[model samples]
Target chain A: MTVAATSIGTPGDLVSATASDSALRRFLHGLPGVDQVGAEARVGNLATRSIKAEAKRWALDLAVRTIDLTTLEGADTPGKVRSLCAKAIQPDPDDRTCQSVAAVCVYPDLVAVASQALAGSGVAVASVATAFPSGRARLDVKLTDVAGAVEAGADEIDMVVDRGAFLAGRYGEVLDEIRQVKGACGPAHLKVILETGELATLDNVRRASWLAMAGGADFIKTSTGKVTPAATLPVALVMLEAVRDFADLTGTEVGVKVAGGIRSAKDALRYLVVVHETAGAEWLRPERFRFGASSLLNDVLMQRAKQRTGRYHSPDRVTID
Target chain B: MVRRPAARPVRGGERLEVRKTYKLYVGGAFPRSESGRSYEVLDGRGRLLANAARASRKDARDAVVAARKAGPAWSGATAYNRGQVLYRVAEVLEGRADQFAAEVATAEGLTAARARRAVEATVDRWVWYAGWADKFAQVGGSANPVAGPYFNFSVPEPTGVVAVLAPQGSSLLGLCSVLAPVMVGGNSCVVVASEARPLPAVTLAEVLATSDVPGGTVNVLTGRTAELAPVLADHLDVNGLDLTGVAGDAALAADLEARAAENTKRLHRAPGAEPDWTAAPDGPHRILTWCETKTVWHPVGT
Candidate 1:
């Protein structure tokens, strides 16, 4: 039993410590209950603000995956995605940036290609398997997808929840299927995406959070990007709270990813601030955190370059993947 | 010599006696089976009071839809409000104790006074469930710790619609025993009321309809027990089931459980061993059951 020594830190600055603990506690208390924390914590202290130069640069490389089993709808999309991967991915495996991209997401079909392309790089090759976006396919198909992705050297597998099964209130079916998929992932990380906009409620969104965690999701992602109203702070906050609760119960920590449509350094920093107040300093490290976005890389790199050189560079001048 | 016709079915002084036919309680109305089907209900003396509603698969589904319509608002209701409604149901049951006693006496072969005690126990069960309406979550839920800087918690949530088999003996008390816990936790249930002594079951439905209990939270379906139990148990949408009503049918109850397993529905089958109707309560039967615990978490940062 790993008893967490409640290192509820005591700084001599009673006001600041009180503020920090209460701020943290308030975020913790508000995490459940389905109501949104309308205002983001504006961390203005000199220490908090120095503040986060690198966190502002975080972004997730999502796989808006398209699998062509029959090659029917968006059948040729995989090959196009491959070209984009080769173009946008770091061709040389030796280069390491100030931060790793969130993940190089791909379909199980091209996990091999993306794995090979991203080989020897810290950028995790995340595959969208287990019936991506729409998980109506059979359980065997979903398990095989997880197995195939891990077999092809995927570092992480983002599986979509069976929206059809869950919405029908076949919660046991949904939970069991996810458990099977997580087991199939072997050592590879599992991220369960709720595809929230389709779920349509903050209450349901919260419930799905616990279901995914209970189902062995190593991370709970916000959306599939196939749906609208992609990534919002409220949804991300709910997912973050889910991870914290799971960690407390099992002593196994979860990772959180806010993917889809996150495009600016400002938004990235906002995510980091939310995390800092909700989780802690240790999560500030990129290993536990990721920003999934196709467009966030350039903007973050642009900001990083500006921080280093004391001046912002032209977007064309930055080396972006 | 011609015996004088009875003033009521009661062998002694009893006002508000139960009718012969036991019917389904749907939408605040007691209606005979829409299917026009009824099976004979035999009291302890083996005399028929009336027929009971042979609740069909369609009736069960329609009841579920009604329950679902009422579920959210009912579940969303404050725990205090739910408790108040449950207490009100008890009050309604108390004022009509004489009617319930006759029904129970016919249903269980009890003397009038004993039947009154049994009905009071049934009424008391509502008060018990009412107290738990809001507190089920705090007791069952927890929080989790994830690696990230975020807050999280797990809280208990209602599993939506449920199906119940009201206890066969102790008809009034057992029916209350099954129905109170389900509705107390904010889930609506369709009960296949006891076939042997269904008069009280139908009478109890009338009591529920008037207590502002909402139309669909508790539904009583009286039919051939073997026929209706499957329809409720096998229902894919029915989230949970109770078998307190089937006292001697272990094999059949097991079969129903097996069928319910298709949806992984939570099954609670009270043992054939008759519970002391006057006892405190069955832990599983009397306590709130099958709550979904949702834990939330947040990051602890300096």
Candidate 2:
């Protein structure tokens, strides 16, 4: 329950001794490949679940609380980060029925500002580190990035996996890098972003998901929101399946976070359905599930307004951050 | 001749008439009023006609949002394509003429002949506006003679989302006259139908949905103008107002225009009295009312 200061496990010993290169390869490759058409069909089917009335109201509120409200712009200033923190604290200032989001995700440099702004608020400050969006920087630079954010009082650190190492069949190197970032994150919980768009296949997504969870990722994220096809239903489904399988094998639960392109209350509910049916109801908690999105919060608020007032809401009535 | 027993009702072959449950048209979907309240629409002789959705102010705000969302794509569409789409609305309306005429006759207490004339005039007005969709820019825009060696031209662009209060008395003809011109220049609109006679508006919305018009392009809400107009007027996102329907209530009209000034929305105040919609002009002025003139300058080569 207390993810902020608790370390999940030690890095090298996290996986079994059988995680040697060939052994890891055999384990990863032997993991079942996904049926693309079947996966897509399942996602489409789950999307049609008509969540209405009380269920819709509950989903909307939970979605607001599950959001990792993000602002990762090159132009993000302290003022913007502070306002985002305020938004995370009280999403709908006009209506008190709305709730605060889970976290405020910003670049590493603005972690302190967000942490201070959201000091008393239950919302956490999550930082995107490890040369985020690319993960192309050297291992030492990535570690410093992690350490700096942890020093700035970040409760959570979202680090990207090195796609170059993974695509080149350097699976051990990828696992090792995640371990290094996890080690650098002293008390901060770690979320390993797969950036599944660049990973090329469902098999790659599955392997990366297992690799991150095996490397002691408190949560495995879908994307950096900088890539096309980020955080899709099938990819999230694969990650969810991986976490479920990993828990079955090791008895440790690693959470799942789906980021990017998820803009509507309907879309959030669909992902929640995937989480519910695939990973069970336990993963429905904020500590276990998160949506790394900015616009998604507003949509959830709008839907909540509709539910409360029994009328469709306007975007103008909500703040335009 | 067939005889039916009073107790047994032996005439079992009689067909039951299925009446429609008129609802508010938002985002191209016919959803009942969110408030779940309905009011009886009656014929002029006070006979029960059907129950119409009593749309709330929330519905008005929703209509504005839908119109705003539909504004860009509808405006970016080619003028020729827009004209064709508008023409298709007229085509669909023509096919449903009998239904519209019946509703008009019942709502207005008009003779069948007069109701048919109203439908004809409404269809003709659409065709008129359809033709102007592509031609209005040419007549309204111009190549300005600049002071320096520059080629400057002014072109009309849609003024975003406009909110219209459809005439209460002339529900069918007046609705078409006010609605068509707002859309001819590519602006999307949220229309509050005639309070007492909203059946025609709902029927027209059905026609629009079946035609080539995109979802959210023209949202129709059946509700009290006094209750809804204030919301639309104060809605910061709405870009323009057509107050022709509020001509009879001067105080209400003044209040709405003042509230509209909060966002400096473009106001088309109601005329002293509802202009004879049957004799409404087929000119470029109405189309240009909700348009912004954009001027571009390019340097001339030697």
Candidate 3:
């Protein structure tokens, strides 16, 4: 959707709004008290801008990943997956002359291979398991999958929360499911994926977020990167509010990961700022947050490298997935 | 005067001789460090006196709970009431000036005369920050320039828990310098007091307890700075850190900063004393720098 030159994304560009939509917007803008007309404009500006000066760097960190691996096994061969993961993980690991991108996400089964490849490396090992994309299997099967992945040495466990129950409004059950998966992870961190597209509305996504925190999920993520309507700012804002609300209650930091559809540096930065302004200044660490996009890695790496060398590497030049 | 009774000091560590035991001063009662562990501190002559706790990570966490539990009502207390509590602390310090002076002398490797000045400065420092409890907002707030008919002003608020590294040489005064600002601003502090002599700090905490300064407002840990500062910096609940003592050690400072970055605790790097803690007046910046910013909202014309 194309936004106007002025504040935030233009609603007209998104979809034609009925009178109800306008009323809700007015109510939201009218919050804290009646204010000048610029209230809506300021809120919109905040939606797009970083809350702090360091937020852009944090946003840049989430977009890129170097799949630190030598081999892989699957429909995508180990070598090819390693290259893909590297593409996902890199500006260039041995740029010996420079710095690079974020992390390299790989399959839980390939964790040993990837860990060996990325050993003595800065790029972290993030694995996708716990019946990712579809968390409808037996609970034991999910726990074993999580245990096996952590045993194989994954730094981050991106598990899919039980969407079936969440869609059915069994919020507690979905939260319990995440708790069980987290229990299986001895020391490995947990990132719960809500798969925003299937959650249907922003409110449910926000509800799912609170439930995930109650279940002890370390980070709440969007999408499995296998669906549409992946990472919208509005949904992200709802999750950010969830994080903000939860932190005030628990004093524990919760992370956010905007996966799928986030294919560029700009969108990634916007997500980072939403987190910063909502979660306060604490959730700006890699261990607490990350991006799970398959296509955003190369762009972030290229952009990060560009800021230094005064030269932009073409998509082909930077070998990120 | 809160007099120190002459008692035989036990071995803080397994190796020691006569060393004094500093009871945990909570709500005005003197008790031992809950962990039952202590380390001996020596004078300039290398003569050991008191056995202060080798406070564990658990103690720091416990201290945070105490501070937070005591926050709402204590902070919500009228600034004047809080000021009255703080003012009493100065009176207590003044009464025990000689004890503090001797400890400061041993800890900072300074003359008895210089130590007396330092100890006295701590009392004087309290009076300064105490008076600011109510007046800070008057000096540090402003109305925004917006096209609006409503009245608005942005003022500083407290950041809650502060992890302080009390200055090594400046001991009592510097400890007061950091802790007083934190409390006057309604922030509770977990302090790693000077390693050489921690007696004065425990004494100060006693004074605080009796002065109505409230429990958990200042938790003083006397152990190894190297061990405690990093742990405090990395603590999840710590909102900010005063790194004044670790400024001389670049590696330690860097380690504290990097670990503190995990929870993104605000690290006020040393050179903390540049603003003349002795002469500086209290302002909102001192207090608000340590407060939580809670922006509230309510629907208009609901």
Candidate 4:
């Protein structure tokens, strides 16, 4: 019934001490519960903050720079990946001042193609591994997924945690998997995907966020873009608070990425506001905050065009990725 | 007897009448103008009838967006289905004839009998265009005899989204006359209602919403034609421009036509003056104006 002394030690020490199931459970359960209604209300109030004029311009460009342009499909082709990489490098082909995106995210097999296409361009290459949207495979298979993507020159590895085990209260098993995957990542940054939609509650999202950070995650992503209710505001708020609190406890600034169903420039601006209010203005940078989206980049680009031209833009004006 | 006299009815002063707020109809919902501006709509006698949403350039932009989004589904629907939906609108309008008649009377400053006739003619005009939904292509398209062994045929297709200016004089009948043809051709439209007389058009929007016609298929904006027309004409997504309401203003019409050329939008040039809506439609020319001729060549053997 006592809270574990997780805040007293470094993240590495915390990981070593909570290596056992009972210890990890006591720490996660002992963490304060999320006030669901309060979190939702706070997010709702923050979403209405009218970011306009110069602030909107800054938010749009920041959104462009923080985007991880993604294309993960069963029928993905090299041509598609190459075009996406082209878009990532120069999102607005006509506007040379538009900044390039942060990264291009794809599947493991397509990493090399994206890596080759985006080479010498400042855009990094990210790949989803560890059984991606569904982490239902064995630990070895999951590690192999990570290893393949890393070998293919993925600058960042986005691996999904085993939600089944975590939901079954097997917190240590999930932590062990994350640590093993982190070790196999070699020199690449590791982003842990909690797929918060499957977590079912904000309390579980907070618990899973701490678990991923404890297991050596460089970033904690919200979803895999394959599930409904992905990357909602309340859920993102909870995860952002977790990372903020974790950074305070360990002096390490872990990043947060909210993927899936975020398509509009308005929604992206709201996310930037949430990050600024919940975490801090420092997390507004590309290194600490990223948007995992494909269509979102185009929307932000269109909004940028509207701002400049003082006229509305149509979908036909932008390149189709 | 004293109690009966005391209970004599108070006709209109018994309670406060609920006044309707006239808002722009965009994307199938009644929303206030994005600019939050409304202008007084006056009758012929200069009496303020109501305040209509003074649609700004942003509202026009939004209406075009809604029309563009609705273009594919509306144009892709079977011609028969479109006919049925348009007919359903007529049926609903028929049921609301008394309400529309009163609105038309006040908006156009016409006698009660004349307004009733206009409303009746408007409903009939809808039925007339609804009948053409399935027949316009047959009358306009043809299979040409080519010298080669290929069957070459030309058929009509809806020209994406069209921006319309409803006639400024005729409130109900003329608005329906122009709108029914564009819709009959399967092209969704963003209509700028008659600036000074927009009450009947707003009432028509209520009928369109309740009918089976899909949302975003027909967006109505009530504001200055000079303000909204240029935005629509210059819009890249709008495939056609109907300047019927600006017929009397040659300078504005010329300006709009020049802007329409920027995007190669099909231009339905305004006439010298607003035409009488009571007259029968002049064949299927109006319907064909908003359609593109798509020709196909098929090998004889295949």
Name the candidate that leads on lDDT: 4
lDDT of 1 at A248: 62
Per-residue C-alpha lDDT of model 2 across residues A69-188, encoded as one tens digit per residue: 999999999999999999999998878867789999999999999999999988999999999989999999999999999999999999999999899888888888888889999889
lDDT accuracy of residue A271 in candidate 3: 64
Taking chain B only, the TM-score of every model is: 0.86, 0.95, 0.83, 0.95
C-alpha lDDT of residue A158 in model 1:
89
Instruction: Report, for every candidate in turn, its global Cα lDDT versus the true structure.
Output: 0.67, 0.88, 0.67, 0.91
TM-score of 4: 0.93
Clash list (residue pairs), candidate 2: none
Off by over 4 Å in 1: A1-321, B1-21, B143-151, B282-287, B299-302
lDDT of 1 by residue, A187-253 (tens): 9988888888888776677667767776788888888877788777767766666566556655667
Superior by lDDT: candidate 2 or candidate 3? 2
* CA deviation > 4 Å runs, candidate 3: A1-321, B1-20, B24-31, B272-285, B292-302
Compute the DockQ of candidate 1. 0.00
TM-scores for every candidate against the unseen true structure: 0.45, 0.68, 0.44, 0.93
Model 4 ranges off by over 4 Å? A1-19, B1-15
Give model 1's TM-score for chain A to 2 decimal places. Answer: 0.74
* Candidate 4 CAPRI assessment class: acceptable
